[model samples]
Target chain A: MLWEMSASHIEESQDVTSQDLDEKLDLLSLQCLFLMNQVISMKVDIERRMKEGTGMLAKARYVMGGSSVSTLQIPSEEAGMTASTLSSFEESERMIGKSLRLKYYNFRVFPSAKVKDDTEDEVKDGIEQKLSNLQLDPRQSQASNPLRWFGVLVPNSLREAQKIFGGVLLLCAECSSIESELEAVIREIDILNQVKSNRQQK
Target chain B: MSDFPSSARPGKLLAIIGDEDTCVGFLLGGIGQLDKHRKSNFFVVDKSLYPSATNIEEIENAFQQFVKRDDVDIILINQHVAEVIRNVIDRHTSPIPAVLEIPSKDYPYDPSKDSILRRAKGMYTAEDFR
Candidate 1:
């Protein structure tokens, strides 16, 4: 009877050891998942900042081309247009300011990649806050173009400015796409995991 | 500055005073001109003469001539070129031929040094909440 009891206790201890190992595996897997999420989100945030900055620059360029968000250019060649010029210069200054601010903020908030220690949620929240800070209110952005004072009313000049702005946006879009490769890896891993699980079942 | 270009104003000419690259670009942009006086609106400043428009007198003379011309209605000067002639630029009060400071091939346009932009900024009366 003593031998039988000893055998039973050994089996119970073995079961406890297996349970402990399983828990450790779960903890390690969570750590890995957390790291992956942080990396993905950081890439996404940086991309978002670039897109936002470029968009602001493009919009400002549009306005500088003599059209506002809500209104087109009026007969600004008149002497009375100085008031409008002031309002528009204010907007130009604001738009350049928005783009510059975002560029600088990105440099400050994302100095380097040592973000491995932070959890996924923390990384996401920090990025969201910075993005919101960089965003400009639509109302304040309606400032008109003061270039009319210089008689830059030609279609060719406007088109040239638009081309420059478009080129810049294209460059920003290029920078924003750098994360697509890593994101593709994430997608492939997901698909592979699903396929492996199905094969195991079969 | 006057509120409007005079009805008798001579228009359709663009005067350029910039570095080689900027001058070449604008000249290609269709503003190249050489008049009877052997005066070409395009003045190309090579760095070997001086870096970044260091010859203030030369730039000032070009800028003054461009501004005083009845045929040229717009003077497109490189921002650095304008920088050397800031005193003369600030002293200019005419609205006939507009003075525009443009970015060069290597230098960017700085609004702080822009006399017109500076004046516009100074005219702000209300407090900006931002």
Candidate 2:
């Protein structure tokens, strides 16, 4: 009888141990799922902002060109219109470029191996470096060509967005930040487990 | 004396003075010379037309004329251009036309380094907000 009791107790202990391990695994898996969701959301937000910035820039450029072509009848009027439009376009381009650069900087500061792999960090870095060089070029200082600036700034902004998305992914991994939806799922599972335990106890 | 927005003015104009890119950007924005017949709405003066040393004088003259005209509402100048005519820009007190310094294509927009931002920071620091 003592042997039998010992065997039963050993079986009970083993069951409890397995249950504990299962709970731990469940929690870990839930956390990982949550983190993934957060990273995806961050990437979406960054992309949306980038698109908006680029769209604004393109619109401004179109306006600048359209206005200049139409105002050519009067020399003074044409000159003034041309100058103003060019300045506005330049400002728009600069603002967009700055936004992209900020994103790029954020991405560089936060490194995510998975997202970075998808973006191909080396390609992004090369593009950004080329843009930086273009900005530093002496010809840009001597002459202000709105068209040239537009060409360089737009592509740079797009590339910067790609880098930023990778950085956002890295931040999520580092902080273990999870999405609200995933958190809700984890909570629901925990509550269900509690209900089951209560019923079993009763 | 006029409380209306500058855009409502029959002769509201904006002047931009700076390098080729800066001037070109302004021009692209529809700023043209003063149209006496149609009520000029905007004007941009490219300082590149003047010798480097005379750039400030030309900008000052343009600003004086812009402000004197009841029609002009805003003046947008490149940061470098503003630097050239800092004395006049700083001394002018009327709010008829707002003056703003903008970044050119060659210059990156550095919010932290912007004079306006710097002033704000200074004010915040003085008030212990920072």
Candidate 3:
């Protein structure tokens, strides 16, 4: 009688564990759905903003007419003369479930050299060294902006376009992070489903 | 469960493979960088500018370089540009240097075409819920 009672107890515990897995799987699937919706919305917003920015840029170019804005604004060659720092990324952690922490990349920016890099050594090269010193001149506040590379007097539309594109970069980064999280959640759900199926087979 | 690729160090740069306007706009946003080798972090995939039959091979080469580079962590490619190299993008399975498809001036985003969205859709089908 005692052996039969223990056997039933074991079966009951296994059933409870299976139920727990099912609940976890359900939650993960819901999370995946939520993340998918977020990514879709963000992508839509990015597309809309990009179109707006592109239109504004076109208007600015028309307003400029046959000027040297495009020809002179060669960013790759103007690296030494750059006042604004480049955008970067860093690792971030967020908890998705109990004992489930996800690590992903978060986009970061230090525009206008607000965050100084102590590690950057002073350049001793010929032309680059001179340009770097030119950037340090306090009177050249205009040089502090990457837009100055385009021209001294930029159109308002150009400035607006820059702002829009900059903002969209952040949205794109967020979408990347969330998509990664969703992938992780889906992977967990897959594992849980396999476990559930294996239990059923046994 | 090491989900991300092997990267003991954090990624430092966000590379771009976009058109002329997209490249110029983002470079103005202050994400442009050139290494000591004079190799730029951004690639200008402008077919109109070149007008010399700039082919998919050039764009694919830039994409491959960005992926191979250790410094670049995020690669933002225009959706239309990405379409030309969808096979390459799909083959890239690593999670560290994540490739994100973005809309360009002429091309709006299509969710059905997004790689991530496609994978997610496969997971939660009607049968899966049932």
10 residues in a row with least lDDT, candidate 2 chain A: A99-108
Clash-forming residue pairs, model 1:
none
- Model 2, A90-176: lDDT tens per residue? 000111111110000011111111111223335455423422322222322222322333333444433333233233223222212
Please state the error at residue B34 of candidate 1 in Å. Answer: 0.7
Interface RMSD of each: 22.0, 18.7, 6.0
What number of clashing residue pairs does each candidate have, in the order they appear?
A: 0, 29, 0
Q: B1-130, model 1: which lDDT tens digit per residue?
A: 1322243222346566876544433332234555545576657666777644456667777788888777654566667777777788878754435555555435644547755445533432357213
For this target, which candidate reaches the highest lDDT against the unseen true structure? 3
Docking class of 2: incorrect
The lDDT values for all models are: 0.40, 0.38, 0.67
The best candidate in terms of DockQ? 3
Ranking by TM-score: 3, 1, 2
TM-score, candidate 2, is 0.35
- Answer with 1 or 3, whichever has the higher lDDT: 3
Query: Which runs of model 1 end up more than 4 angstroms from their true locations?
Result: A1-202, B1-11, B51-54, B124-130
**Of the candidates numbered 1 and 2, which has the greater TM-score value?**
1
Sorted by lDDT, highest first, which candidate order results?
A: 3, 1, 2
Each model's TM-score, in the order given? 0.36, 0.35, 0.75
DockQ of each: 0.01, 0.06, 0.32
Q: Please write out the lDDT profile of model 2 over residues B6-62, one tens digit for every residue.
A: 332223345545454344323332344445454343334454464456655766876
